[model samples]
Target: MIKTFKSSLFLCAMSALFLCSACHKEQSPIPEVLGEYLKYHAEKGKTADGYDAYFDLSDGMLAAYSNDTTKAEIKSIINKITGNKNCRNIYSLKEGTVSKLDKSQTELYNYILNPSSYATVAPIEETLKRITSQGTSAFLVTDFEEYSNGVIQQQNYAKAYFVDWLKKGGDITFFITNYLENGKQKHLYFTVFDMGEHSLLKDIENALEGSKSKYTRFNLTANVVDIEYGYSGTKGGCYHDESGEDIVSVTNESGEGDCFTLYKDYHAEYYPFNETWANIVKNAKDLSEEGNTPKFMHLITGPKVNLTSLSGYNVKELDLKVTNIQDDFIRFAGYYEYTKDKTINVDENGKLLDEYNYPNKNNATNMPEIEDMLKYAGCVQDGVATLNVDFDKDFNGTSSKVKPLDLLRVDIVIDECEPKYDLITKLFSWEGNNSLEQAVRNTLQEVNPEGQVIYTFFMRDGGE
Candidate 1:
């Protein structure tokens, strides 16, 4: 998932406001919005054991009116007192600690730290005062974070919907954080903007109404399992075998004898020695002519040891297998042998191995024509490759069906300077301000100035 944070316009406003009122005497504490948010966390009683900070507003204190100097001073004090540790779970709702905000603003604060983030259109102060904005329009802002953990851009898709709701005589603002954090089980934060005038009570009511809007939530748990394989030797044990009656063979106590002799006197069991059993005799001429008897052997009842655990055995030769035949998801579990002697240095001329790669062809014409060229744009399962070049229909219009056989050269615009034979989405992303096709055109001309760009344009066509 992309780990980017697309900032809403509210962030810009907040920055400007902070710079404006960062410094001043008789300053206030953390904004009431954040204060109330901390209070909520405190009330929940789930906050980790640490310093908990809060805030209260002073008279004539304006969140939008603070100077950078005062803000900096306050931040400095917070840094000095809290150091690197979080505020202990103590609610310090003081006016001079941080800027003061209103109850709705507090809700906005909660929304930010909550995964389900969105902005509203009511001044938090007015909301706290139980006032409402009549005949006023409000907007809900939704933002996204990118894969590189950067703010790419703020989206305004919700504005039209928000305006529609407002024009319908909606009297409240609702914000919610319904998504689960993806990593590190960290806290999520959001900032709700008061884009319109309205009463706090009505805002809450509206929020409640909008609570029925499409919402999604998720949580994840991690589980890990491990398995490993190895050899053993039996000491102070003599191999023995029980023979039938009538034959009582005897052997000296010195242990030198044939199998039958030892079986009767010393009760030695006659068993197959090893895998490469050449002869029962230790120094037979034919056995010597062959090779040394295998050292390690296997037996169902005899003393046996895992060869992997034995000394001098190369552990790297071991193999592992994992299979998932019945389950919602496939699983893999295995471990490598950790014997120190198993490590071996390879020559510099050794070739490196890879799991996946496209064929390195000299020219596109010589390459095999992919059944679906779009599917193998960059040779991987990238999404951008599958983008259809034919203009099937206009997307921006009311009609949803694509006109049959309407083929046009589509110049899919994207952020990439070079068109890769990868999946459509991976090859190029239309994440920035320009249209995908436009971006593609600009990038294409830059790369191939002499050749004409071959592609169709994506548009609603207005005919739908």
Candidate 2:
């Protein structure tokens, strides 16, 4: 059976390299980033949840191998230090390659430095060697390592041993799972931390309690964690109060005392562009009114799925809007709105644009496979415009199999240019196989050729 890699859970196994190293000296300074992550987990538990610790030894190794610096000679030194005449076990080399000083060596070195760039069938180190042996750019492939149990233990030891290493500066982030293999579910927990303070942790706790996602449901009890307590076995799922009783049933799921919220707290931190886009829109309106300047408003459009509480439940369509109002910033917001109908002209000889077509997408939804779920509407104006969509009926289904057709469609209208905005719009199509979120990214990239993307995932249901 194929394991469903839920977007919210089950990360592709990345290398165990990011973890701390146990073989380090006690006086060595800990990488501040790892420390912040640990503190966040201990205090907040938001982003730090389920994160296997990693210590980046690549920088040190690279420094040792630098061409100019004679401060350290890594290869020969390490070879003799192991004292094993056999280099095979000490260093994993590429196939058909006996030495690390061959043409593939540079490729392997690049892969080791940036393992995240390549897709490796094995850990970063082993995978890099394999790819390099094929006489190709390691950058040409995907390389990520799924941390193993041994890696996890090494990480723990690094944290324990390298207390000084963490004294350096770094930041922390966390991820929360909608569901794990175990039936454990509760208000989502996450945390962020810095060298000087633990407020990020506190903020994460608060966000968890205040998160709008229904998946953030916690159990109640002393040893048990929940958003609702006291009334689970007695009253209904929600907590209730007695008539002026000195002591009421201790069932208050919203963290009766001292509980923190995850999303509510870190929402701004994660979604920095919320106000940035709003401000841009407001400024554009003011400018337009003052000078009658014709400004272009672009909304990068795409699909949104509301997978909140999908276990034996139903939901409604979740509407989303992506607006780029300012320079180098974009905002993606989820809402409840009527699905808008949009039509675009495709000539009798229509050719797909390369920009809108994201080639590496493994999860692209085919039109035929989702024919019942999606509806193809028109090729109007003598084949000038074609419209098709798949929408969520209520966005209430537990799986994507039962969503409404025409759920989300956005037209990014460029407002101003020496070149006509219409000319730019013609260069791209809102209807494509890419997800709504990706569509937004593509649209924004066109508007600001140099702009960076800032995306946020949200879900809004009016029925609630």
Candidate 3:
């Protein structure tokens, strides 16, 4: 009877050990993934099949370009356009009509110089609509001075269309030339619309090198900024992975491998290592004639910590607070919860599934709202912005310590960047302006209210 009881006890112990091993296999730790959707790749410029050139035959435009030098500049622009190894079309733009003209330079010049022969005024909005409808890149030469029934143009009718074009990811390059029209200095604009990845604008820019013209180019392309971990080699006991530009592994000097420990008293500050402030100053100086400093606003969102691995630790809630050391920079923080029902789907190799990708959650609904936690004044000095992240914030007034072996997959995004350059103000004249100023201002304000994401960073925190 005693021998039988001993064998039964040993079998029971073996069964318990097997069950424990199976549970451990099922609860594998989550892997750290960063920068899944932060980088922006710009479409490369290519040569188009053909291009269109439109000349406004209005009296103002004809008179502005009638000078020998200005006329030569116009012909130079046309020659550059036709110089390409593709068919080019020239058209006379007037009063909601685009009539094809002879490709001959003499005929084109004759048609452009004789304003009285074609005395109809072209509606700017109609011309823009025509260009947009064609869905092809084109050049528009005009004085941009509008007349309605021989009255001064009052309202900006083309503002809405320009805004629409900009919002649709189109780019515009304005080549402004100054000339004396009727003994007064006037401006003639050569506007190029780039609807796709075409090298037309660059070609024109190259062709007009050393020419007396000022140009301004604007596009809806994403502006990405570089970021680094820590300030002045002070990583606060953390190390950055050289393979990833945005990855930060939180480990001490003695720690080895991917995971490391963060004690309760862990604290650190990171600075934007790039020449952001210097560039701001340079951009303002280069673009501004009035020496006015440009203004930029930053919108910080989401350091979404994937707390899937912390489930075994009973981590009901975790609070990660980011404080801005400067008042000029916005102050915001986030609180995260470990949802037991939410299981991240991963493949056999531990890579996240397509639906569960990181840094791609750009939808505002998926982002956590900013709650009142802590505020620290950040500072900008020596052309660098310093920001601090405190991990020791108390949770539920009970625990302020991050549990050992806990893994935090932190993903932070920076978006809605507004870098208002003074060049915009210098682009158009407001005094007795012929709707250009109003149109430009309205379009800029409407289309770019909240700029796109400029940077996204990923960080991981683990306990020993």
Candidate 4:
């Protein structure tokens, strides 16, 4: 998730390969080995995007050919990207030891592992060619809050699995989220890092952890689409009572009363709805379809941060002992009131407008653009977006009823970062000039005292 790529691959290579290689036949100059690598990958034709093929000559010597005199100054930088405290883990893989690597991985690993023996070995250029050409990606969904002080540093497959993916020209994108059920914070993390770059983050692993939180509706009722009408369902006319008595169901010409008045001249068949209800639905659907830009009443109580644009509710007071069944998800029974008012039109229906703008489906919108909202919360990666907004709406005969827990579940879709090609494997077996190689290493470390400097060797095959 960090923006700046760290050059820690050599460190991992040293640990995994120092003993296995003809690499340790004697002390090879740091610059020579590395410079040779850049030249070699270029000769074989590889791309490096904007990332130039270079090495921190000093860092390589300290880690691979010398002692550990420096530490990576990147803890604070890592936290900036991951939203976690310390840099949890930066997993890498080395030659001959990548787990579950396919045939292509095996060939590439072998070639890099024994450069001395590579003359007899055929090139795995086709595998690398296919990978870089087609391109691949990863979607790493994480619940970073679950980490203790934001640390997930026990580097195993859980952390390092993406390395092989990157090697195969797959880029990675991370989606970090905190889990919640029944409005209670789970204080847990459920993540899935897909090399195949699947959008869904595997499963929502349920576990009993710290404390639980439930969504409490503070009687915050929204008047979603208020409609003033004469009479909708069964506009009364002449009707017989259960006792076989003739009865009339209104006192005035307007369809407004429920009392049975004396019946003399009443003759109108029952109709179920009025123009008011039809117009209300039509207006609501239109409002939502055209990008819910208008404000509506949104009622929420307490210390939860809504990382979405569907905010700004008309605050109200309420008290209701809601669904008490213990569960790990927020239950919804969408049913908001449609109060009959003295006036008969869809005018300034305030807070109710707000709720329906984001939650109402089966009307104007079937999906909510929550990904746009996620950019503020750091679910940021260009081209990477989320899909499938899971929400439910209640309706009574074409009239939508908004209720508790009308929410858009937090999930993301990321277009994976394409792996950058590097021309590091172009190094071919050539008799080394010992004095020249030694002079290169001495100059490599002697450049600048402040830190290791990048000593780029112009790739032999014009790789970049």
Candidate 5:
């Protein structure tokens, strides 16, 4: 999730030792380019949701802030602290690795500081090479801009390179330092911070060991925090134009709401709840314009059984571990389209009371788990590009014959609403004996009278 906010980034002076040296006449006069670097993130990490801001660099790009005077002051401080006399453009490092770089290190930087290239691609040659051989640590990677002949282009490989880098040997929390790359970017030095951890595999293990319930539904929910999406990271954001994939687009360019939508299934008519923690949803997955059709929305490794209402019924959290099965993976995806008239709010998990007093997620907020009810409908691509989970631990279903079913909940916390979406739950009462399609039509009239958004789930391939 790459953010592009406009404000001065407050620099808290830190005491980290950087390896800098004096430059010769051939080197660019710029003392040192200060900026943040992104580390390799794997798809097989732990899984947990709730506002977990990568306080560690906010990890993804967000916000649009810029302050030159303040930034200059920070750079001055860095020069005094590090005593680094050499300054060079980000491209200089690409000429070749600095002699002082540690073994297997690739000195790269990104145009992350660039608002225009924020959504576009970037160069990763030097960095990608490192991952292929002995592991490498990059100073900068996806933030550079390249112009060929008269065309403006970016080399989009940081993500793939990072995945490969993690496999070889990567550190979630590593070291970084920024420099005065140019007039636009000031001295942005790197400091260490916490990169929240998640182990989807571990979550599953714990769930299975806890308890069991005959009510076989895996009620899952993705509390979306923030939406920093778009292929255009220029001054004003733009749409994604690059092509080469499989996600089929439903609508072309509409006026206000989502101009494009890719539904996961005819069932889950709803969404892409990327990643979380800070109540902020930052996507770390690779997003392409082509992969639009929802073909992979199943929690393949989950229990096998019949399910009841997700939030309507009482059940154990452990049953929702659709993520526990080895080789199989869990994916939470959906489409969403927000227009000026149709507004929605994503409320996080809070504390509340059920029929009986207890600490339940429902207690925290009104967002209920989607169970045997209407699925979903939205407009947009799937969630983030890099969320993947594969469990290797050994475990048998709660019962050899009776497999538990997994059903996730996606709470749509609607705030100050438009007339049509008033008191959405009213539709839940209309689930009469009519076919789901008919029920949906009537429900849509009550909730989304104008068809703002809908909810449906994607059944995993061959999944009952």
Candidate 6:
């Protein structure tokens, strides 16, 4: 009996040990796939509402430029807008007032053909001011030539109004159509103001397809950077399956809020997080006299990393490790920087527990000396534009290794993203010497000094 009792106790001890081991295994952290995280955050632009149509019946537009092609284009525009059920109102901008005109084709055609039947023309600024006041997406047809007193003042006012509109998330597209007027080249402007959430500009662009018009779309809204993972020739444990497309999950390390587990024995030949410029405006016609197409650089400034849940990190020592440095990484390495010292409290699940003052400035006080460590790589070469992460050397020229189960939280903050000034100048300027055209160009340069953040996404290291 004593032997049997001893044996039973030993068996119970072994059973308890097995159960505890099973529980420990169950509690182990599992990594999350990086591709799944990106797929989850990928969003599409929202569709906008209808549009309002406006036509300028000014004397300059009626008297100076009346030709068969011009009239056909005007008629096509009017007919297209009126035919669409989404077109809400048609207004004739003349006589210093915005008069509501019938949406019928006959009425609009008659008004266009017989300028004498209409009242005297008003300043073009009046029509622009009315569009600004209504705060809706609109389509306007005009000559863009202001022939009135205080042209500078009118241009300034128009610039101020449009700048405010752009600041509040608005976009503009200028369609310049050229026609022959008695052997002299003449131009007419068809402008689209995309205010609020109305995106009728694309529809109008589609309507004018195959027509002889030059397009310059000014999207003043913040540019959303596109993050693509597992780019071409990517390898290692980042992927989840044999297909090599889906990424593995990033798991938190030991329930620590900040520390994470990426993967074991992971070495990427190419950096996984590749960023590309979004919402690039493609001009329809090359207006350069030298036949040189304007090259654009999407300058990304003030990039920093932050915790997904917390406002900032509070750790004393932070290290960045980069291996396999490439030559292209040295070009744009100045843009990446580390965050300054800040106190943050997060829960075990990586949720913010206390309120912290988030840094708002562009200058980072504590920066890592990782010159040529990582860069915003890729540019237009041979008519192809590519942007990605290409890092070839070690951080600070010192070899720092990423151990197994180390998780990194990369938050790419794009403070300012815009094209170089040369592109902006080419897009806004025209062939004629018009003061309003120059003013519009100046306003574009001033307002677009620093582009806004059109997109925001987070990246993590590790996968299950």
What are the per-residue Cα lDDT tens digits for candidate 3 across 1-464?
Answer: 00000001112212221212322222111111111011112322222445678888765666676677677777677667664654367777776467887657566666676656465776666777877766567788886666678765768776766766656656666777666666766667788777654466667776677665554444322221223333222233222334322222222332232222221111211222122222323332333344422221111111222222111111122223332211111000000001111222334554443333322344122223223322212332332333333222222211132222211223232222343335444555434664776676666666553323222222222322
RMSD of 2: 27.0
Top model by TM-score, which number? 6
Deviating ranges (above 4 Å) for candidate 1 = 1-95, 98-464
**Model 1 over residues 364-396: C-alpha lDDT tens digits?**
111111121111011102221221221112222
Which has the greatest lDDT? 3
Cα deviation at 169, candidate 3, in Å, is 1.7
Give stretches of model 2 more than 4 Å off: 1-96, 99-129, 132-455, 461-464
Selected candidate, larger TM-score, 1 vs 5: 5
lDDT of 2: 0.22
Q: Find the 10 residues in a row with the least total lDDT in model 5.
A: 30-39
lDDT of each: 0.21, 0.22, 0.43, 0.21, 0.22, 0.41
lDDT of 6: 0.41
Candidate 1 global TM-score: 0.13
Identify the runs in model 3 with alpha carbons over 4 angstroms from their true place: 1-51, 83-88, 105-118, 214-426, 430-432, 455-464
State model 3's lDDT.
0.43
Residue 317 shift from truth in candidate 3, angstroms: 31
Per-residue CA lDDT of model 2 for 1-464, tens digit only, reads 21111111101111111222332211111112222323343343122221111112222122222322111122222322233222122222222122322214344344444434222122333433332232211111111112354331122211211122122222322222222213322111121222233333333344344333332221100111112111222122111224311111121223322111122121110111111222333433343343432322211112122222121111222222332211101000000000110111112244222211222244233431221221222222311222112222332122332121111112211122122234223221122212212322232233231111111222111110
Any runs in candidate 5 off by more than 4 Å, and if so which?
1-95, 101-124, 131-138, 141-374, 377-464
Candidate rank order under lDDT:
3, 6, 2, 5, 1, 4
Superposed on all Cα atoms, model 3 deviates from the true structure by an RMSD in Å of 16.6
Which of candidates 1 and 2 is the stronger one according to lDDT?
2
Off by over 4 Å in 6: 1-48, 63-65, 117-119, 147-157, 179-185, 196-198, 212-375, 380-384, 390-433, 449-457
For each candidate, what TM-score against the reference? Answer: 0.13, 0.17, 0.49, 0.17, 0.21, 0.52
- Order of models, best TM-score first: 6, 3, 5, 2, 4, 1
